[model samples]
Target: MFSTVYDVIVVGGGHAGAEAAAASANLGAKTLLITMNLQNIAQMSCNPAMGGIAKGQIVREIDALGGYSAIVTDKTAIQFKMLNKSKGPAMWSPRAQSDRMRFSETWRNMLEQTDNLDFYQEMVTGLLFEDDIIIGVKTALGIEIKSKTVIITAGTFLNGLIHIGNKTFGGGRAGESAATGITEDLVKKGFESGRMKTGTPPRVDSRSLDFSKMIEQPGDVNPEKFSYLKTTTALKEQRSCYMSYTSLDVHNLLREGFDRSPMFNGRIKSVGPRYCPSIEDKIDRFASKERHQIFVEPEGWNTIEIYVNGFSTSLPEDVQDKALRKVAGFENVKFLRYGYAIEYDYFPPTQLTKTLETKLITNLYFAGQINGTTGYEEAAAQGLIAGINAALKVQNKAPFVLKRNEAYIGVLIDDLIIKGTEEPYRMFTSRAEYRTLLRQDNADLRLTPMAYKLGLASKERMDRVVEKQEKTDLFVKFLKETSVKPEEINPILEANNSARISQSMKLFKIAARPQLNFNDIQKINSVASFITENNLDNEVIEQTEIHVKYAGYIEKEKNQADKLNRLENVPIPANFNYEKVKSLSIEARQKLTKIQPETISQASRISGVSPSDVSVLLVYMGR
Candidate 1:
């Protein structure tokens, strides 16, 4: 019954798929989102939270690029936090605890309202291909849907197998059935694939827990939102999360199910996420630790269902209950559902190009768990990039690819294509070397302009970025040009434990002091009046302050990035013959041939390719 040739068809409706559909359609393409169940769109499969550490920066970047993630998060947030407030602005990250039901509902509502987008409920069984290029998808019911481009964001659903102790079932999620045919079809088409495992924590009944015994973790007194746009407001009457610990007794009780544990007993062969290991994995890895922390978080504004964070396990239900009961605040906890681990097929990301399009198939792209990444933020970022690039390819335009120095999304895609993660990949601040320039506060300044040049970001979003840039620039200039008299600044400096200046100094210079801040400096009459007259908000003032404070460091990073980008400009032909470069090591040759890096900078980043190999390639290219 599907006769129309859609511009783009996105398979799976998780965070990644949703963004892909929204992005492609927002770019004026006729797009269709096919999910196994429309009700579960944008489901929070693990935690009921968004944006933490590096992931938060990614959400902001997505929003700056006109993606809907940050807006949806802000609309549904029940609690808000700016994590790592004590650290530098580069470390600062915005996080939100979302109402799970509302998060899903918001996504569906936005998608329905979005123009040029359509929705369907169907399991994509196989891809329709002509030669090596993808043409469309075939559903389980044998309905063939035609599309010019396809983005597969099938998160943990390809031949997925769930395990809880000895019980095993074929399911994508806890209750959803596993998707078939696609993985086998792809493998037969000469694509390499492997297995990965990820687990979730049990959902406990909030009424059953004893919160009085646990420490309450409250949200920010003055909460902030994820969106740069004013679509969402700050949360009021936030719900507090509780922190509890798992004692030695709880560990010993959990260990009782070691013999039945699928992870330990070899039932699960794939590696799980190293950063977010399960409770049993933690106990096994960190035996010296007497207790592990557990966070008890509320599921939503209305529900009594609580998420037992930091207690993810795939142990038997009896053992899970027994161990959980021993925790200080969960003495009589009742499980809404037992946690389980699921193993699913994933293609090694090295097979994909920097634009996230498959080298083997034209107009076909992969994002999210299908590319072996974990976390909703990571998936969503990938989806946005993939969606943008896919639409660009369809329209016969230049492919959009972020660089390592520009954004975290850039580092993520570069890392995946170059390093090719052995286990499930998750974003960390350490992963981006130029993180100082990639702060959450300046995501719009970095990406929105680029996105505007493309058709993806709206004129309103572009105008906001322009205004913010103009305001920040003016504020910085004011700080640099305005001088503070010793009498105007000495009292503030003395209060902050800084030496009082004997003479007048520029406000920018005073702000550069380690102990001083913009808030204290703003108390000066001239500075305060200047801010008021310019209509500068906290965001603009903060941006100006950070720029003045970290100008030297930011310049140094930019210089380094520019130096490396010179190497990046040295293009390598797609069909370059690495075999002819006999001076290269055998391992380097094989890796270079397999990865087929687009630039010399990318070649240098590959694991086996050494500096000597790069030198040889440089010489060869020069010749």
Candidate 2:
């Protein structure tokens, strides 16, 4: 192990690192996964949940690409809910609250079972470089191992500084030690470094709190799984999460600790997630709001630990306790762990290419928090792409990059590399311009073929994709061709409060009505007969409905995406000189020069670049 060279060495065993190792190894690369503590592999460092809103789509996409996040989540999920179900299919996202310990254990078992992969327990101290390219990694014990590529998914470990009240300590997580040497080494090597902070809420003893005082939020009546694979099944039994609210009194109790709060007292300067603000931040930002809802979530199926969601704080321990006592259902709460904030070092993702390989260092990559992204889904997506690209580079194959229209993964990376987040970047459905075309339900149909071609997805997965596509198309055809009598369809239309049909109509037309959903229209005798005769599954039915109901919107989005794709597909020469474009704006030239965008479309997305700059580039390219 000491003398042999590996194809890819993945540092950090968080979501990103684990996925990177798995993807690299599964692609036939001799991969090695190194972590400070092997037992904590793929730990749910923050919330004990996977997939929410756009995040759920990301997990499904990972599974479609033959990664393991969805499978693990589904297997260990205690609670499952499809978020935004009231909205369109594009907004419907599947989420799962997992058994925290079992989630990590499941990930470890999966990694252990992956062939061509090795595990090592050590803290990486620095990189072994061949000039500008990283050749391997150096461990804390001074042992060096050679590798063709190194992916650092260090997460919140690099120079981690935790805060509680005015007191700060060196810890990546609550108890784990902060990593050293690597951040300093990279800075010395001329990488631009920045700081970002993220925090977790206190985990209290569930038995100590009165759930009757809070609202019971149960899982969906018919809970769904995240993975497209049939191997993982839906939850047969479920767990319920309780909801409580923080009042003006709770806010007043919290404000008393403001003097000691690291966030408010200027003890912590780095930015946290804008979308997921802490309790203090929320209170301070929205002073007039009477209350903020708090969700009390169980940590596992058999545990007293309860995560106090929506109450993330870095105030004194007593302050956290005092504030929670003021809340309705927590008059006598016992904390298992106090809430605290941690600041860590991150490299601006603009330093990375579309494939996540560093522009300055060949074969070297960064994923997860190191790339300034928050959430397990974002990190795992980056890791999966980095791992795949690293392995492809080693195997002398073309790098795989997803377009923004193709997947949410594409929107994330494109945003990171182009916009370059100063704060922690998170994914949202609104971030995707073509979200309707990138719905969570159709990820397999969009991505499995590509993954299969890359040798990442299995033949079974490909077969599933083909069957889904063929059946969905056939069902849609049947709906369009078959006609239903007015008497048969009128009752169903009346049930939905829609005007009765005067005569016979095609089932497709009836299904497309704004008021009539799949459930409403499926009651028709002909539709039910067709479903029973074809033996179509729920997935095929859902796909066919989405295709039929949102056909115009979907087609509109596709046309828009195809139009923009022309500019996206325009290639910029690798050695293209921005210095020659003197007619471009000063800020545009400077940003373009530094970013070195690969296409005219990418150039337009840069902050300083305007339409005029893009026009100049288009003119120069003789388009």
Candidate 3:
């Protein structure tokens, strides 16, 4: 039924593929999004939520880059909270509980509204390759659609295996069929693939839960959102989650199913996510601990389904029910759905470049769980970057890539492409070295301009960014240029528990003190009042605060990053033979040859490579 050649073709319609298709189409590319089932587009298969820790930063960055994750999340969010508020700014993350149905619907609607995007419901069984470069995709019905660039984000559906206790079946998600043929074809075509596993918890009927026995988990008093755009509307009367604990009784019941558990019985061989372990694994690993926490989170505003957090398992259904009833507040819980583990085919991310394109196949990119990473935010970030690069390739323009210091997305992609993952990777604040400069508060400030230049960000977004920047610059300048009298500011400073100033000081200098804040200074300084009088938005205020509070650290980080970039800029020749370097260690040569790092800096960071090997490389490159 179709004969048009698309600029970009996106396989699978999960978070990654949806974002990729939207981005490419919005960038004026004729994009085609093909999936096994169109109704499952952007489904929250594992979790009914979005954003956490460093993943939240990625969502904001995607939003800043004109990707649709943030907007879609906001439109469908049922509950919102800013996590780690008591911690440092670098650790602060925004998380939201979404309406499962609404989230998928929002994505479908947005994709349909997009100008240059076309939708197709079909399984991509194979690829049409020309001289080692991907030229198009072959559908299950034997129709071939051509494209200049193809992004594969099949997620966990590619040869997916569902494990329930000792029984296994071919399925992507609960009730959804798995996609086959592509993995076997790719393997035959010389692509290296491996198996990875991930699991989800059961859904319980809310009516059967005993709320009086559980601890109430309320949302933040003043909630924030993931998107920088004004698309977020304040929720009316937010929902509250509850906390419960799994006791020894629960553990004993789960142990009864040990023999039948797929994880223990060797029925599932793929490595699951270490960070988010299954209930049985958690019990096994943490035997010393008396109890584990479980959260009862509502699936949506309208649904009666409650997600049983911290209870992910592949144990038998009878054992699952027996154990779940023993948990606090769930004595009468009814299992609306049983939990299970999913094993799927994933191409080790080491085979990908920073652009997410496979080294084995040109113009063939992979993202999401297919690349061995977990979480919707991580997938969407990859999808967006891959889409941008794919569109750029179609336009014959230079690829747009971000530095590690520039974004969390950059850090994530860099880690996957450089180090490669042995486990399902999840983003954390500690994973980033320059996290002080990668705060979520300023993600839009760091990325919007670049997106605008690439013609991905909208004009309205660019205008808002420009205005915010101008106002923040003015505020920062005012603080730097203005001087405050010691006598006038001392009382206000004392009220904030800050030391009294001995002499007059620049407003900027006083604001930079750890004990002082914009509000504290506003009480004594005129410039602070002027800033308030302008009625700037919260995002603008947040930027000014961060800029003033972290000036020293930011400056130091920038200098360090500049020095590192010098090494990054030192490009390595692709055809250079590491085996020729006789002075290099055997292990170093092997690693260098396998990774084929794009720069000397990347080569230096590989685990087995040594500094001496880098010296050999530098000497060989005549540096």
- Where does model 3 exceed 4 Å of error? none
State the lDDT of candidate 3 residue by residue for 1-623, as single tens digits. Answer: 67799999999999999999998898889999999899999999877889888888889899999999989888888788888977778888988888999999999999999999999999998898898888899988999999989999999999999988877899989998899888987888788889999999999999999999999998777778777778577666678889999988889899999999999988888899999999999999999878999988888888999999899999988899999999988888889899999999998888888888889889998989888999999999999999999999898898888888999999899889888887899989888888988988888889999999999998899988889999899888988999999889888888878889788899988988888766676676486577668877777777888899988888998898887798898899885688888898999888888888999988888889888888888888888
lDDT of 2 by residue, 1-623 (tens): 48889999999999999999999999999999999999999999889999998999999999999999999999899999999989999999989999999999999999999999999999999899989989999999999999999999999999999999989999999899999999998988899999999999999999899999999999999998999998999999999999999999899989999999999878899999998888999999999999999999898999899988899989899989999998988998999999999999999999999999999889999999999999999999999999999999999999999999999999999999999999999999999999999999999999999999999999999999999999999999999999989988888788779989898888888888889888877787778888899889999999998999899999999999888899998888985888888999999988988888999889889998999989999999989
Model 2 misplacement above 4 A: none
Question: Which lDDT value does model 2 have at 583?
Answer: 96
TM-score of structure candidate 3: 0.97
lDDT of 2: 0.94
Clashing pairs in 3: none
What C-alpha lDDT do the candidate models reach, one value each? Answer: 0.94, 0.94, 0.89
Query: How many residue pairs clash (N, CA or C atoms closer than 3 angstroms) in each of the candidate models, in the order given?
Result: 0, 0, 0
For model 1, residues 307-358, the per-residue Cα lDDT tens digits are 9999999999999999999999888888999999999999999999999999
Tell me each candidate's TM-score.
0.99, 0.99, 0.97
